[model samples]
Target: MNPFLKPFACHWTMLDNVRVKKAGDIRLKATRSAVIYCTPCGRKLISQAQIDNYLHETKSKLTIELFVFDCKANMKQHYCPDGKILDADISNGQENVPISVVNEVDKEPNK
Candidate 1:
């Protein structure tokens, strides 16, 4: 196993959009969705339901850390950009495995 990769567990955080009112009060508003990523690799998970299904099928324990951020876009721009999206394939029936698909942003240039 690679030291940098923790494939068995994931991390999830709630992203909130904040706004400043006229009274100079800061308010935190929850977004429509949250962002889930691999603990070590920072690979983004499609949804909470998908990860739950994958963990259930694989009998793997998940370690979640609740981090609240003001902006979802900032978090995606900084951390999730380095890793590709992780998709769990449960349809195969043999074994449940998480697959990392390479997006255009995650591709490397030819040497």
Candidate 2:
């Protein structure tokens, strides 16, 4: 199997409209193609074009899903040139997934 298309079981994190420093680049701002994965599963950068193709094939633009494995990886920021915030479903099903950042108080327990 191609290294690019490996079976990666993990949660998806969307770097939507995120502006920040890029990787391995001196430039302060960059869309650095990010590799997304479940912090628990495996890590890999899926291809965005591949995901688009899959959605196109299904002929349903209603639910856009990011495949954790295969060619659904993106090059960061959804490559939106029009500066539009494209709302998407980060779920693997017809349901919505809730995500939250850990609070400082929660970290205290680890200390």
Candidate 3:
């Protein structure tokens, strides 16, 4: 069995206050609230469609990796796009910050 599928207490990033609008629209339309990340692996599973696709592709029966907190272990079980798992440290380090702030920072160009 893949160890990544095992359940663990996960530090989750809750998605809230998400909105979308046309280029000049004054009102921001609210989007559904969701839990976006497991934090430790930096992987996001935002919607049912996405979750279904992942399960279909991986043929995985477990959904625990989508929500569990111990993503470090999960991270070790997967490969990167380059066909390898990242060897460097993996940490979001913003576990205490609001998701809105994190989203803004993610939008900025890396210095």
- What TM-score would candidate 2 get against the native? 0.20
Q: Kindly give the number of clashing pairs for every candidate.
A: 0, 3, 1
Off by over 4 Å in 3: 1-32, 39-41, 63-111
RMSD of 3: 18.2
Candidate 2 ranges with C-alpha deviation above 4 Å: 1-33, 37-45, 62-111
**If both were scored by TM-score, which would come out higher, candidate 2 or candidate 3?**
3
Q: What does candidate 2's lDDT look like per residue over 1-111, in tens digits?
A: 322223222233433322324442223234433433322223222355545554476574322342443224443323323332223333435566733223333323222
- Better TM-score candidate (1, 3): 3
Every candidate's lDDT: 0.41, 0.36, 0.41
Q: What value of lDDT does candidate 3 attain over all alpha carbons? A: 0.41
When summed lDDT is taken over every stretch of 10 residues in candidate 2, the lowest stretch is 1-10
Instruction: Give the alpha carbon lDDT tens digit for every residue of 1-111 in model 3.
Output: 335334233343433434324332323235433324333344455555665675577666556445433312333355433222222223455556433222232344324
Error of 1 at 109 (Å): 66
TM-scores of all predicted structures: 0.24, 0.20, 0.27
Q: Model 2: clashing residue pairs?
A: 11-38, 46-73, 47-73
| Residue-level lDDT tens digits of model 1 in 1-111 | 322123332443332354444343546656434333332334334445655665566576542222222234453333334654344443445646644444446455323
What is the Å distance of residue 88 in model 3 from its true position? 55
